[model samples]
Structures are given as C-alpha cells and as structure tokens.
Target chain A: MTTKMFDRIALIGIGLIGSSIARVIRREGLAGEIIISTRRAETLARAEELGLGDRYEQSAAEAVKDADLVIVSVPVGASGAVAKEIASSLKPGAILTDVGSTKASVIAQMEPYVPSNVHFIPGHPIAGTERSGPDAGFAELFQNRWCILTPLPGSDEAAVAKLADFWTACGSNIDTMDPNHHDMVLAIVSHLPHIIAYNIVGTADDLETVTKSEVIKYSASGFRDFTRLAASDPTMWRDVCLHNKDAILEMLARFSEDLASLQRAIRWGDGDKLFDMFTRTRAVRRSIIEAGQEVDAPDFGRIAVAKPAEASQGRD
Target chain B: MTTKMFDRIALIGIGLIGSSIARVIRREGLAGEIIISTRRAETLARAEELGLGDRYEQSAAEAVKDADLVIVSVPVGASGAVAKEIASSLKPGAILTDVGSTKASVIAQMEPYVPSNVHFIPGHPIAGTERSGPDAGFAELFQNRWCILTPLPGSDEAAVAKLADFWTACGSNIDTMDPNHHDMVLAIVSHLPHIIAYNIVGTADDLETVTKSEVIKYSASGFRDFTRLAASDPTMWRDVCLHNKDAILEMLARFSEDLASLQRAIRWGDGDKLFDMFTRTRAVRRSIIEAGQEVDAPDFGRIAVAKPAEASQGRD
Candidate 1:
C-alpha cells in the first residue's frame, strides 16, 4: 500500500463520483481514515454496505469534524447546502474541494460557507459513467482521465498541489484553471451534450410516426450514442443545467444558430456547405483519438482502439 | 476457418459502414471471394492493402459480374447510380442489397434500376464507428448489433432469409420493417442525433467567449460525445439528411418543440417538471440498458451489455 496523503478525508454525498473517490483513495492508500456522508439515508446505507469508507455519518457536518481534507461530491445545486452544513465543523488548515460538474456555481455556492482558516479549492474530475449511486463506482474509473482543479485566486498553492497529487495518484492527469472559465468551458463540452442528448431522446420519445419500439430497435444507427449521454444521471444533469444556466444558455443559443444554418443548407440542397462542415469535424475526432479521448472508429466510438499507430498510418 | 456462405460477394463503396461490412463478412467467412469496389481508386487500393477483399475493382459493373451476392455500401444518394451501373452485369437470381440508412429513399432510388431476375433487398446494419475509410474495417464490429432489412412487398422470402442468415452469422440480430417506417424510425434514432451533435460541435467551434482551447480541454464533460457523433462520415450522414428529408424534418420539428418546453421549464425554475422529466428519462435509459443497447456507465456505453437478462428482456 502507498503512503497516506491525509490523516482523514471526508466525502460528502456518496454517489458515483464520491464513491469513486472513496474506492480510489482506498485502493491507493491516500487517506488514513475515510468518512462517507450523504443526505439520503438509503444511499448512505448503501455506501456503508459497499464498504466505501472507514466511517459513515448521517450529517455532512459530523463527517468533517476531524478531517484534514473534505471532498463535496453532490449535485451542483446542493453544494451551498453541503458547504453550509460542513463549514463550522471543518478542521482548520483542512482542504475543501468538490466534484461538481459546474465549477463556477460550485465555487459561488461553496466559497461563502468555507472558513477563512481552511484552504478551499474547487475541483471536477473529468471522469464518470452515466450510472449513479455508490454501486456504480469502481477504483479504475479515473485511470488515464483528466482532473481539473479550479482553485480560487490567492488560494494556497500547497493545498491545491496536494489535492492534485492525490488525484494523480488515483490515475488522473491534473490541470488547473479559474473556476468561472472552467464552468464556461464545461458548459460547451459536457453540459450542452447532455442537454442535447436529453432533448433529442425526449423528442424521439414523443414522436408519433416513429413508435418507441422502432426507436429502440433501430437505435444502432447513431442514435444510441446520444442515448448513452441522455441516460446519464438526470438529477446530476438537471442540477448542472440549473446551476450553469448562463453558460448553457449561451452555448444553446450558438448551437441553435449553427443548426439553423445547417438546416438552411440542407433545405437549399447546398451539399458543398454541408460537406465542408462535416469534413472539418472529422479532424477533431482524429485529435480526440490522439489525445486518447476516443477510439478510432468510422462513425461512432464503437470499435476498439487501433493496434498501433504504425498499423493505422496511411492505410485508408 | 468458417465455411463461406456465398461463392462470391461484391461490396460497393468503402466508407465506415461499408468497410465494417467487409470486415465482418471476411471474418465470418460469409463469402468465398469478396469483390470490393468503390468510386474512388484510392479507396479501392486502401481496401486491397487492408486485405479486405480477394479482388478489388474500380468499376461496379465489373465487380458485380458473376458474383453470387452483391452489396451496395454507398451513401443513400449514390444507391440509384450504383444500382444502374451494376444492373446488367449482376448474376441472375443473386441476392442484391444496399446498406443505406434510409429505406424508402433507397428503395425508390434503386428499385427502378434493379433487374427483374435478381433479388433486390434494402438492408441496414445498425453498426458503425466514427472513423471512416477502408482502414476502419473490423471483423467483430457488428457483434451483437441489429441488422434491419426492409424487403419490398412480394420479394423472395428465400432471398430475405438468406440475407438474414448472412447477417446473423456476422453476429447481428435480424429485424424486418416497412421502408417508410424504417425511415421515420431512423430519423429519430440515428439522423437527429447526428444532426444535433454536428450542430452543437459547430456551435462550440464558433463561440468567442469559450475559446477552442477551453472547449477541447473540458470536452470530457459532455461535448465530447457530440463530437464523436459529429465526427461521423460526412457523405453518408449528408445523404441521410437529404434522402430521408420528410422523416428527418418531422423528427427535427418534434425535437425543437420539446426543447422549447424544456427551455421554458428551466427558465421558470420548474424543479418538479424538471425532476419528473429527469425521472422519466432515467427509466427510458434503464429500458435501453435492459435492451442491451447501452452499458450502465454514466458517460459512454461502458456497460453496454451488463445484466444480460435485463438487456434482452426489452426486445420487441
């Protein structure tokens, strides 16, 4: 087992992300004692059954009393409440962070409640499956993935680095950015995708001509990818949508406008325009594959990774 | 080695879907002599280099000559042209099929050109990856996927069964549906998802406030899924949009309308409505997972085949 990074780590909200952290911390021996807390008694019970931590507490405040690090892993909308609950009990010099999808709102909700003595840093690990609850997490989930730390300006660098080192030990590459910028960036990347997936899936569900059975049957033709995204934890996504309202709205506006142009092109039979836009997007997929974000497949990320770069070069 | 189902099989076009077909066909020994053809010479050479076929031909007419089965694997727009080109040269009583995404449009485009003696069936294997070209072909790509065949009324059942058996051997479950129904169903299941993904990616690319670097960095949140869908083969998707115009437009209209309602719910802070929608959508995801269409992961198809009984239980 590895050396512990903290004497105790308190996890508030033991859902997919939180449970994952618990598993990773346990696997890597990052914390001497891990405390798991959640608002839902049932989920807390489930977390306990899963043996996710060394201690279990019904109250977030109670969980953080003696912790050297506290990680808030709740829906973005609940960050404020969680922070408010744990603020007074947090040990001075303890590092406080979160795994919320929207960083700006999380910071906004969490910053005010944090005590001046504690080192509060905001973070979001860019890794998770659509599955939720404590049972959905595993130790290897963060392997080769990114963990973004949205440290507040003037925050303690040592505290931030410690958290970064912890995540790195959990098998993630760490990067730092401003909380607001991280929120805006995520609005386009993660937020908009879920909204679009949810919107499209909902739209299909309501269609009269294309019965639900048919949609399910024929989903392999590209619709299934969106469903994967759409199938993501609704509470988490809804909270993200509500919390990151401005950035999401801005991204949605731009998306709608571009879609209109694409619609116009299709309506007018401007195949060239459609072709150019479609062609340019393919390069991005290549970059993503190179970045190890996706596998090299023809139309979706369904196929396995290519054997070697040598086998992939210039064959097509 | 597996027994070859046909003495000779001709494949037209060598894009993502087409190449995958070639890959699976070869792996399953569905054809004794795989004859590959494409409009582009470069693509044909690439297919040859990948060892995708026994014989590569630049002319569709020559490729289909004496072949026991002919598979047209081109964009929906090119179905008619390919049908016409190979009409006279196709072996009598052979099974001739096209794997275009849209059924009605493909039937309309190719039916008039097909010879009276050959069995012409429209088939779509609901399998593909985001990468294209001959290099993207893989033998196991169609494992446990769906393959829908829209055979015209009064077409030979023996021919249909033969094609079904072929795809079954290639690891796809077979389903039959009306051409028009296939178009409408696919519009929701495949076309709209691609359109939304493309539109959203294009939107993010055009944004000034959210720099491209930011978009790329935080893409793991959700936008990356859209990028994967958006990065699909442009020609194939473009043809799908144009050829399945009516069904696509109908689906798009429904999507926009539903999105408007969702937008309003968010704007008004209707948490109950949001929660209800989120809750309902969550069940749909469960059904999909049960149906084997997805895994239990929160992000992608991480647990696509988890809980086999649950996945298979939702079959129509």
Candidate 2:
C-alpha cells in the first residue's frame, strides 16, 4: 500500500467528476480521510449510502475546516458561491482547486475568495462519458486521460506540484497552461463540439420534413454520433456556455462560417472541394488515435475492417 | 447448408457495402455464383485475393450478363454509367438494385438506362463503420440494421419481395418508401450529420488559437466523436452531398437558422433557453438507445458509472 498524500481531502459537489475523484482517491489511498459535501441533500445521502467518503458534511464551510486538499467539482457558474462559502473555514496552506471545464471563468470566480495562505489552482480533466451525476462515475475515468491545471502567477510552487502529483496518482497525465489558453483550447475541443451537437440534434428534433421515428431508426448512419455529446448534462453545459461565452462564440462563428462554405460547395456541386476537406480532417482523427486519446478498436473510433468471415461463419 | 436463392449474383462495386454483401451472400449461400466487378482493377484484384466472389470481371457488362440479381453498389454519381454499361447484358426477369445513400438521384440517374425486362429498384442499408475498403466487411455488419428500398412506379411486386427477402436473409429489416421521402429521410439522418461533422472537424483544424496537437490531445472530451464521422469515406460522402443537394441544402439552411437563434441565446446569456435545448436533446439520445440502434455500452455512449471500486479493488 502507498502512503497517504493528504491527511484529509474535502470534495465539494459530489457529481460525476467529484465522485470519480473520490473513487480514485480511495483506490489509490491518496488521502487518509475524505469529506463529501454537496448542496443537494439527496445526492449527499446517495453518496453516503454508496460509502464514497469517510465523513459527510451538510455545509461546504464545515467540510473544508480541516481538509488539506479541497477540490470543487461544481458547475463553473457556482464556483464563486462555493468559494465564498468555504473561504473562512479553509485550512492554512492547503491546496484549493476545481474541476470546471472553463479555466479563466473558474479562476476569476474562485481566486478572489481564496485565502492568501491557500493555493488556488484552476483545473479541467478532459475525461468523462455522456452520463452525469454521483452515480455516473468510475475509478477508471481518468485512466490515460489528461488533467490540465492553470496556476495563477505567484501561486505556491509546492502546492501546484502537489495538485499535479495528486492527479497523476489518479491515473491522469498533467499539463499546465495559462488559464486563457486553456479556455480557448477547451472552447474549440469540448465546448464547440457539444454546442454543435446540441444544435444539430435540436434541428433534427424540430424538423418538419422528417419524422422523429425515422431519425431515431436510421441514426446509426451518422446522427447518433452527435446525439451522444448532445445528451450530456444540461446544467453543466449551460454553465459552460455562460462562463466561456467569448471563446465559444468565436469557435461557433468559425464553425458556422466553415459550414456555410461547405453548404455552398454542395449547392454548386463542388465534389472536389467537398472531398478535400473531408479527407484532410481524417489526418486529425488519425493523430488522436495515435496519441492514444481515442479508442482504436472502432468503438465509433474507426471500425478497422475485421477479416470477412466466409461460408462457415456468421450469425442467422 | 441453406439453399441458394439466386442462380447468380453480380456486385458492381467492391467497396465496403458491396464487399459486405459478398461476404454475407457467401456465408448464407444465397447465391450459386457471385460475380464481383469494380472500375478500379486494384480493388477488383483485392476482392479476388480475398475470394469475395465465385467469378470476377473487368467490365460491369460482363459481370451482369448471366446474373439473376445485380446489385450496383457504386457512388451515386457513377450510377448512370454503370447502368448504361450493363443494361443490355441484364438477364430478363432479373432483379437490379443499387445501394447508394441517396435514392432519388440514383433513380434519376439509373432509371433511363434500365431495360424494360429488368426490375430496377433502389436500396440503401443504413449501416457501416468509418472504415471503407474491399477488405472491411463482415457478415454481421447488417445485423438488426435497417435497409430502405425505394421502388419506382409499376415496379414488379414479386421482385421487390425477392429483394426484401434477400436483405432479410442478410440480417436487415427492410422498409419501402417513395424515392423523394427516402432522400429526405437520409438527408437529415445521414447526409447532414456527415456535413456537420466534416465542418466542425475542419473548423477545429483551422483554429489559430488552438493548435492541432491541443485538439488531438484533448479530443476525448467531445471533439473525437465528430472525427469518427468526419473520417468516413470522402468519395461516398461527396457524392451524397452532390446528389442530395436540394434536401441537404434544405437541412443546412434549417440548421444554420436554428444555430443563429442558439447563437443569439448564448450571446445574451439566456441560460434558460440554452438549458432547455440541451435538456431536450437528451430525450432523442435516450430514444435512440432504447431503439437499440446504438450500443447500450458506455463506450463513448454514456458511461453508466460502474460502482466506484474501493482500495481493495482497482488498478494503480
């Protein structure tokens, strides 16, 4: 067994991300004790029933009183409120962080209330399935995934390193970037994809020409791919949109502009132009798969052609 | 062994769909003789090396000469030429069909060349992985999938029944509809999704703020989902765009207009509107999952949060 890294770890907002951290911390023995806290009484009760923590607190303030590591996993829009609530009760020299998707907004919201003695680092783990909630987490969610930390200027170096080490122990690779850069990168990769997916699914849902039944039945062709991202937690995504407006708007504008050009090509029957863009984008898919960020076994990744089974093999 | 249903079967394109038909036919013993032909000699040779057919021909005309069932699985744009090439050689009373994604344009292209003696029907199986090649086929590819057949006016009922039965035997449920309706259905479910996927992936590739490496590394968050569709066969998709122009452009116009409204909501921080759209889309995902068109597995398809493993269980 490994030595415990923290005497007490306090988890604020026990949702998918928070509960996942709880599971990994327990699995890795990263903390001597875990204190779980969330605003929802039912979710807290559920977490307690699941034995996700050694202690449960009904208030965020009470939860952080003696915690050496405090990780807030609430929606970004809620960051300021949670930060203020726990500010007076935070342990001195403890590392304080969050698992929000938008870094700049989260930092702006939480950094002000954090005590000078506390290390306030902004973080986003680029891992999660479409499911959300306290029950929708697993210890393996962070395996081979990336955890990005945006440390503010003059932040304690030892605290940042400790936070990074904690994430590494949870089976995540760590990268540190400027908060603004992290926001921009995430805007294009996560935020825009989810927004586009949501928008397209909404379009299909609102369609007058096609039946919803047809869309559902034939979704395997392509539409279902967008549906997975579109089905992500609404409250969390709405917070992401409101918090990262500038970067998301910029990415959305670019995506719409590119889509307009593609629509024009289709109207004019420009097959070559259409083919070039479609083919070039494939290199990025290959890059991601090679980088080990995507499943290579075709799990909607790229169904590598298995050998064609002949006469003696196949299901009826 | 199952009895052969046709004296001979001719497949005019040796790509993913066509090779899959060959594999399934061989596995099920549905054809006494399988004749495979493609314009590309390299692809034809690969099909032969894989023993995907009982016979091979360089000319599509030669392939169809004695065949009782001819399946034209070419790009929609090339449907006219293949139909013209093999029209004279098609056996009388034989069933002729094509597996292009767009049914209306394919009918327009191939109908004029079909002889009076042949039963010309258009079909599209709503299935496939991102991979495409003569080698990327399995008999199980069509299991539980939908295959829509668009029969022209005065089509022989017996022929349609035969074709439907063939697809059923190959492990697909068959639906027949008007050509225009099939095109419209496919536009929303298949064509628009591919275009949007290609567009977003293209948009991410051109971003100046987010490097390609950044996009690749953090893709698991959402971007990788779009890449799977974007990496699909470009030639097939370009034809889908060009041939299904009216319906595709219609969907795109609707999509862009809806996106503008969504954009406005985001710009104004209309959290309720954003939340409503995001929440509404989850129903569609749930419907698709319940329809069994999608994997119930969390595989990028909603991780159901396996019970969080404790210290006694889990990888380090």
Tell me the lDDT of model 1 at B147. Answer: 89
Q: Each model's number of backbone clashes? A: 26, 0
Q: By DockQ thresholds, what CAPRI class is model 2?
A: acceptable
Number of the top-ranking candidate, with lDDT as the measure: 2
Clashes of 1: 26
Report the C-alpha lDDT of model 2 over A1-316, residue by residue, as the tens digit.
Answer: 4758999999999988898899899999999999999999999998998788999999999999999999999989999999999999999989999999998888888888989998898899899878777877778789889999999999889989999999999999999999999999999999999998999999999988789999999998899989989988999999999999999999989988898899889889888999898899888988987898875444431222232222112111
| Residue A261 lDDT, candidate 2, scale 0-100 | 93
lDDT string for model 2 (B147-222, tens) is 9999999999999999999999999999999999998988889889989999999999998878989999999999
Which portions of model 2 miss their true places by more than 4 Å?
A: A300-316, B301-316
Clashing pairs in 2: none
TM-score of chain A of 2: 0.94
Stretches > 4 Å off in candidate 1: A296-316, B1-5, B296-316
Worst 10 contiguous positions by lDDT, candidate 2 chain A: A307-316
